[model samples]
Target chain A: MSSDRIAAAFARAASERRAALVAYLTAYDGGFEHSLSCLLAAIDAGADVIELGVPFSDPSADGPTICAAMVRAREHGATLTHVLSLLAQLRAQRDTPVVLFGYANPLLRRGATRFADDARAAGADGVLVVDLPPESAAILREPVRAAGLHWIGLVAPTTSAARCELVARGASGFLYAITRAGTTGTALAEADSDEDAALRRQLALVRAATRLPVVAGFGVRTPEHVARLAPHAEGVVVGSALVEAALAGPSVLGASVRALREATAR
Target chain B: MLRTPVDHRDDDAPGSFGRFGGRYVAETLMPVVLELEAGWNAAWADPDFRSDVARMLACWAGRPSALSPAPRLAQALGTAARVWLKREDLNHTGSHKINNCVGQVLLAQRLGKRRIIAETGAGQHGVATATVCAKLGLPCVVYMGAVDVARQQLNVLRMQMLGATVVPVEAGSATLKDAINEALRDWVAHPHDTHYVIGSVMGPHPYPTMVRELQRIIGAEVRHQLHAEVGKAPDALVACVGGGSNAMGLFAEFVADATVALFGVEAAGCGLHDRHAATMARGSEGVYHGMRSRVLQDDDGQLLEAHSISAGLDYPGVGPEHAWLHECGRARYLAVDDAAALAAALQLARSEGILPALESAHAFAALPEVLATLGFDRGRGEGRDVVVNLSGRGDKDMPTFAAQLLARPETP
Candidate 1:
């Protein structure tokens, strides 16, 4: 099962006494062929899980870097179906667990159930729609898990403990603890500040509420950001930094994810 | 002190417009928005807050703007309809947008936020937001699409003169949709000290519901004024819809009144097929700007750029409540092309000496199509009463109006 794959990835990282490195890259960001090469490179460089960001025209929750990447990806003829096809091709080559990430409109345009089943058939292990909170997720949640794909939940510092429990109810792959209360590429606040102290409290709250492994993300830029997260959560997701690297080329993205991978050591 | 803490145990905060409106934002915004929802609920429920908003509307926004009888314009259209104009254009900010701006600005104060941000398409809302912020001594930032900033230069200058910084967003066709995306980005980054005063009855829950409540003063006044003038319910209520705030403001009072007919006219830039903002005619049901409304989107649900000579009406989606009303057949919606709206503006200016905002001209253009149906022709005496919401004045649209009409002295 997909949940077992995600759990095994976490357990494997734990056996090595290190937090897992989940690298993110937009499918078709540079171009379909370029993105595929970068994805294969990141996986080869020891990324425990891969988050394949499906390009969208209006990515409201993202910062400028990811937003621009999505625009470039769309210009390259990206779509949910096209990204799923990319996923299928990647699956033919590798066994790394992959999560499909995007907003709700594109997934909803394809019909929630249809998209979930298609994503699963494409060998997707999990799904995370940024705007589909637990309140508005009813239409997509059941179909997502029933397709044998894990349901990943995002918990922010602003989310109260009870809401964290509500999110963890159906969550499977992992709980994403937002390290900051901003979009995807804002700089994470310095430690010892009120925001850093608040994030620590949120991690404690999420830890108390869910059995699902918590992976802190949002604004995570460097190995230092991953190292900061390693002590508090089970994993770290490097998104914009890796995306910026992929735009530079495949080798730069490989070196970037590898550096993040090394920072996961306990 | 925060008026409302993020203490929600669930996602059951108010602001659902019958399955169309809900908080569909990211988790980072989810809790803070819930706090906003709670703050709004408490503020509105208090008699003090209600009175404060009412006082501001009357004193600052020029509430109870006269319902002028436009018999000359009505007769020129060759309809028997006795047309009355809800003169929202005469308000302090030259539009009905001030109603929402003042309300949201006050809400921000009560919530203890220090900065104000807004998105504007035509700059009317931006001007209104800047006006209110200036009065209240809050720093204001307005996001406008680069396309709009170029066209609506007068209003842009007005906002800058009012001490608000105007930002021209260059992303995504560089229009209202892009401006809104930029505003949402700004909000998420500075959630603790910022309040996004959404200018229309669009976006996610709470915003749809909140904006509707703020603008409802228009319809409420129309009811009392029409009652005193003609002493009966109107036969039909007409307004132009961009994001549909002005129309919803006028229609909210009459949705429960079975005797009144509601008509919402959308912009057809040239024609629906070639270029237009007629979401009701061409859009499919999907989510945009936080609400599930009739949206102009491609098959993949990517938003399509809307076109209208009037920048205010060039939006890709309608309000969620308007969507529900269309779903249940409570209102009739149709398209009014740019040429027709241009003619309507010329007719009103010649007949009644009033140049309406191009957005408001769309409502006037629909008067002919709707009045004949209500038996408001020249000879008919019964069921001839109609009210058209002139949502704003034409001062800001003079450049576009002059260019479109082009010095043809004789009225079309």
Candidate 2:
């Protein structure tokens, strides 16, 4: 359950022309069993990684659908512990790495060190504390590393080269490059010259700053977006595009995994 | 006069009510919200302040707004409960919101502050603030939700006309709450020179208290007027609760009056039974902005998005003191749905020729229920006096009201 193992899985998936499908499901989005069904479906549909969102009181950077999903999850009595238990179930079934994606509250509420230990024990290989940046890395990095978990940091296009280099130095496993300034689940349309240039420069800066690989995410809807991002980073992360597929399909969870696999192949 | 809490005593700490009001902001802007809070706090304490406000009310804003008695409303409800509305609609700027904004802006001038910043929900406060800033020759920056700006184009134009800068926040839900977040971020970014005059009685400690104190002028005046007319205070008082500032302002004067019932009506967009914005009826103790108050939160304590026809009352949370009063059983919380509030708005306009602000109509809608609680037949002909704070005028809401009316020709 080390973070290194999780990064390696993604690295392999990228090299094989098979996307590392990251299926997103809030624990107890419906019932516990329904949540388990979604989890199982994602795995069966070829998702290499599953990102379980730990619902919180305030999720500042969330889209309507994801926000609604989080509401549904909380309504069904899901907590950080509940999410970990579900991840434990998945780990029992397969060796696929599970990533815990959430804001800092639940993690802080759960006690960062304790959360890291529990996440690793419950089959989680890495953690993405969305609000915490390199400046505040001490909040989670040491504990995560001690618990044999990867600390994945997102570098936005707006981030400066110095900050990007700092992120690279602090990052373990791989660096995540968030494509935009806003929240999740929006489509990638046009790019600003300054932003695109800054992202490329940041990637180069990250490469120079650390040995870890960098992955680009946010608005990677199609193969074109992937192709555009692939040459610049180690891999591409498609969350909203796959989420859209899940939402459109009869089996949202299964469709997400399949859409990602197909999109990466194309 | 009943012994108000020591902290609640007027002129105790210059701008403070108890431990509540003080300047809590970044060091740069520490002088601004503080200087303004202090100047206004001191000015309102001056006997001249009340007279100046009164003079403005009469000559400029057309004050002594009619105390319209809703007789038809009284007759239909089968009781003699008289509904006397303080016609804030008669004010030049339309709503009672200008009452606070004008006071603050005048005080801002006294403090040598040249700029004002504020956040608006439905653009009522934004327009009011912009108006005051324009009249006082002060620069104003009003943060508003992009969605609201699009919907409330007239108000946006009004603000622009008043020479206030409108920054449309495109973040989060693109609503009042997001507008507030953007405003706070702006304040944090430029705390040194700007005075952030909060629109409602929410935010941190001093804000909820200070705003209520400023707004108390409404209830204080109403209390004297009602006393002169009826020989005693009305049996019940009602006001709409967004962040509950209006209600808090009106209710504060009567909190110690055990016999005088106070009612705070929340916007139940659908119903309180449904997932609506009835924070007092449906919410629990939670902290947001600065104060620990009742907020519309889901099972995991996540703040739920609130829905209401009135943008001012569409907030997902109630003021901390309102929450505390509810807990102490000093005030009753009622839910007024969007349809009910709209109906009340139109009814007031048709009956009294007073087009009430959407938020104020929510208070009007709850009058029927409050009268019923006071042993009068609901919505009927009783002479039992009930004072409802008509917080604002409906001019700003005309476009929205017309649109809604056009969409629902069948539903009066």
Candidate 3:
């Protein structure tokens, strides 16, 4: 099943004594063909998991970089249906775990049960609905779990300990521990300061709350940043930086992913 | 004394108005929304909390705003209709926004929130929130669209003067919707210490119902005032709807009165087919700004930018309750173009010495259509009473009015 593939990816990374390198690319960032090339390139360059962003009109959680990529992807005719077809194409050639990252509106519009069945049919391993909190996750969780697709949960810096436990209980494939308090694409604070300490405390709390693999994302940009966060997290997700590289060209994105891969190795 | 219809109180479901309202926010903010729901429920049932808000409304913000007759405006419409203005403009903050602000600030205090954040379009809500924050000794932050900050400079200054920080949002559309996006982000980041004082009877749950309850005083007072003055309820009610707070306030009391007609005027920037903020006239059901209301969106469900000469009404969505009302035919919504609204503002100012906010002018501009719909004609009709909600004063909109209407004609 899809959850087994996600589990296998983490297990393999653990056996290799390195953190899993997860990369994100908005579907149709440049265009369908170019974006598909970028994703393939990232996988070839050593990304274990791919977070395929379904371009949304109002991405309130994202900063300028990701927001700009989504706008470009939309202009290039990317939609949820278009992204699912691209995922099916990618799945045919690779067994790498792929998570469909998007907001709730499209999924809600498509109806939860049908979206789960369609996503699974398209070879998506997981679904991360950005706006669906644990309080309302039941709306999507039942269908997703029934379809054997992992329903990813997110815990933010502002999330209280009690609430974190509630979120962790419903988390499936992994829990996304957001490193900072603000939206995605913001710069992380200095690695060893009060902010970093606070992040460490939050990560520790998350680890204490759930047995699921915890992946850290949002504001994770550089090789050194990955090296610093690898100890606390089982995986690291790189989004905006890779998107910036993808926007530049496929060659640049390949180099960027390779560099991140080498950083994860250390 | 006028009797409030018992059936109007029957639909008491939390966070929903006939499939139009629900919490569509991110998970990071869900716990906060749930907590707010519980707090609001407890507070609503508590007599002390209710009386405390009542006292604040009566003593601080000035309650029971006058219902004054507008003979000149009625005469100009060329109808035998007798028009009365529900004077919310005379409130402490120069608008009806204070009513909700006072109640929300009190609720925030009860919830142990020390800081407050809000989003504003015309700056009336921002000013009202800042005023209550100042009175309560709490720090306040207001997010406004960059475009709104430029147009509503007086309100920005007013908020600052009241010791609140104003953050200008430079996101999509740079208007009310964008400001709301920024405010929601802030709420997610600081849900523990801050309370988001939503300006209108819109957004997720609890908020739409809570704000409407606080504002219901407008319609409730109108019922008593009209009863004493005209010896009966007005035949029809008119109010402009941006997020539909003032209209909801005035409409709630008379909802079950089969004899009363409700008219909600929306801002049609240029026209309905052109750039306009008439969401009800040109919108589809979609989720945006934490509510599943009728939103101005493209075919792909992307929110479309709404435009209006009046900054207050430049929104892509209305309150969920308004959408329910429109769908069920409980109230009729109409669109008034920019030119007609401005003309009405000027006419009211000239004839009655009352300069109304551009938002309120939309309702005045619909006077003719409202009378025509009622089949009332000048000097040869049944005498019917009409009440139009003067939601705010024109002080803040004077600059926009001057630039648009009072400026000299350009020389070629």
Candidate 4:
């Protein structure tokens, strides 16, 4: 099962006294075959878990870099069905946990149960519906869990304590801890002591709420950032930076992923 | 005064209009939505809050705005039907937008929010929100699409003059939908101190319900005005539907009246078959910007960019209530092309000396056709009264009007 794989990956990283490197790449971003090759390259370059972004028309939460990737992927004729087919192809070669990261509209249009079934059949380990809050999660949770896929929840800097508890209770695989209070691709103020203190504080709050591995994401660009955030999180997710690299081709993306992975090593 | 009982049953369940409206936002925004919903409900139930809103509407917004009889317009159309205009164009901000803005600003104050944020398409809502925020001594920020800012420069200047910071959003078609996304992102970042004054009745939860409630005053006043002047309800109520606030407001009181037919006009940019903003005419059910409604989207659930001459009506989605109204057969929706809307605006101006906003002109454009369909003619002598919601004055649109009508007559 994908959830078990995610748990085991985190466990192995913990034993090695290092954080797990979670790499995010948009499916079919560089055309069907090239994007698949990019995913394989990321996994080979030491990405412990893979997050496959499903390109959306309006990615409100995304920053410019990811938005550019979406535009490119759309221009290349990437659709939800195409992404699933690519995932199926990738699953044939690797057992690395793969999660579909996207908005709710497409999944809702596809019908929640049907999407969960298709995703599981395509060898997806988990699903992170970015816009689906806990209040509306019932639309997908039962069907996803019943299909043996993890329903990951996101905790933001603005999330209240009570809501944090709810998210922790419902979260599967791991909780995604957003480091800042803004959209993805926004630069994190790693140089500012005050900003770093606040991020640490938020990370501590998220860690206290759940025993499951908490992965920190958003604005994580350099190895220095990964090193700085490794203590507070069990896993670090690098998205926009790697996506930018993938734009230059899989070779560049592989080197970038390897650098981030090496930075996670204690 | 025959006052109909306001139905609370429709909004009893939070964030739902049939199966349409729901809190389909990010988890980061869930708590804020719940908090805002609680605040709105408490304010709604409190008599003090109700009176406060009522007092502000009357004294501040110059409301109980006149319902003027448009005899000249009716005569020019060669129809025997008595036509009355609900003069929302006379409101403080020269538009019906002030009604929702004032109420929301008061609600934000009651909720103890010190800062206000809003998303605008044509800049009417931005100007309205900025006006209210300035009056209440609250700092305001308005997000407008870069494209909209370019087209509606006067409204942008108006908002700026009212002491609000206008941010130009440059993402995804650079229109109202993009502005909304930017505003939502801002709300997510500043959920504690800031209140998002959504311009329309199309967003998630409390907004559609709350904005509708505030706007219901339009219909309430029209009903009273018609009853006093003509001793009877109008045969029909007509308003243009963008995100549907004006139409919902005008239709709120009359929805229960089986005798009154409600008509919502959508902007058909060129025509229904061409680029248009007629969501109900050629749209499918999908979720976008927190509500499940009839939306203009591709087969893969990607939102398609809507086109319209009137910036206010250029949206891919309609309000949940309008969708429900169309589905249940309570109200009828029709599309008016840009050329027809422009012609109606010119006709009204030339005949009655009332230059209507392009958005309002859509309703006027559809009037003659709807009247013909209803079998009202000069020979019929029906004498059936019809009320058209003149939603805003066209002073701000003078540039577009001059550019389209005078500067270049032959070209669209």
TM-score of chain B of each: 0.95, 0.88, 0.96, 0.96
A1-266 per-residue lDDT for model 1 (tens digits): 55577889999999998999998898889777898999999999999999999888888888888999999999889887789889999999998999999888889999988998999899999999898888888788889988889989988877898899989996888998888877898788797788888888889999999888889888888889888888888998889999999988889989998899999987
Q: Which residue pairs in candidate 1 collide?
A: B80-B376, B80-B377, B80-B378, B81-B376
Model 3 achieves a DockQ score of: 0.46
Q: Could you tell which candidate, 2 or 4, scores higher by TM-score?
A: 4
Flag the better candidate by DockQ, 1 or 4: 1
Give the alpha carbon lDDT tens digit for every residue of B1-412 in model 1: 1111123112354565556676688877887788898899899999999999999999878888989999798778777668899999999989999999999999999999999999999999999999999999999999999999999999999999999999999998899999999999899888889999999998877888889889998999999998888788887899999999999999887777767888999999989888899998998888777877888989888889899999999999988888777766778897999999998988888899999999999999888778766667555645467899999999998998888796666644
Of the candidates shown, which would achieve the greatest TM-score relative to the real structure? 1
lDDT of 3 by residue, A12-68 (tens): 998888889999899888878898899999999889999999888788777788888
What DockQ do you compute for every candidate structure? 0.77, 0.06, 0.46, 0.68
lDDT of 4 by residue, B1-412 (tens): 2222334256566767677788788776777888898999999899998998889889999998889999888887778888889999999999999999988999999999989999999899999999999999999999998999999999999999999999999888899999998998888778789999998898888788899999999999998999999798888899999999999999998888877888999999989999999999999898889877899988677889999989999999999888888877778899999999988999888877898999999999998877886677553436688899999999888988888887875644
Q: In model 1, what lDDT does residue B286 have?
A: 87
Task: Summarize candidate 2's per-residue lDDT along A24-74 as a digit string, tens digits.
Answer: 666667757777777777778877666777876555455556666776777
Sort by TM-score, top down from the best: 1, 4, 3, 2
* lDDT tens digits, residue span B199-312, model 3: 998988888989999999999999999889878888989999999999999998888786788999999999998999999999888777788888887755677899999988
How high is the lDDT of residue A50 in model 4? 97
> In candidate 2, which residue ranges exceed 4 Å CA deviation?
A1-266, B1-59, B273-275, B378-383, B406-412
Candidate 2 chain B worst ten-residue window by lDDT: B20-29
lDDT of 1: 0.88
What 10-residue stretch in candidate 1 chain B is worst by lDDT?
B1-10
Q: Could you give candidate 4's fraction of true interface contacts?
A: 0.67
Q: Model 2 Cα displacement at B389 (Å)?
A: 1.8
- Evaluate all candidate structures by whole-model CA lDDT and list the values in order: 0.88, 0.70, 0.88, 0.89
| DockQ-based class of model 4 | medium
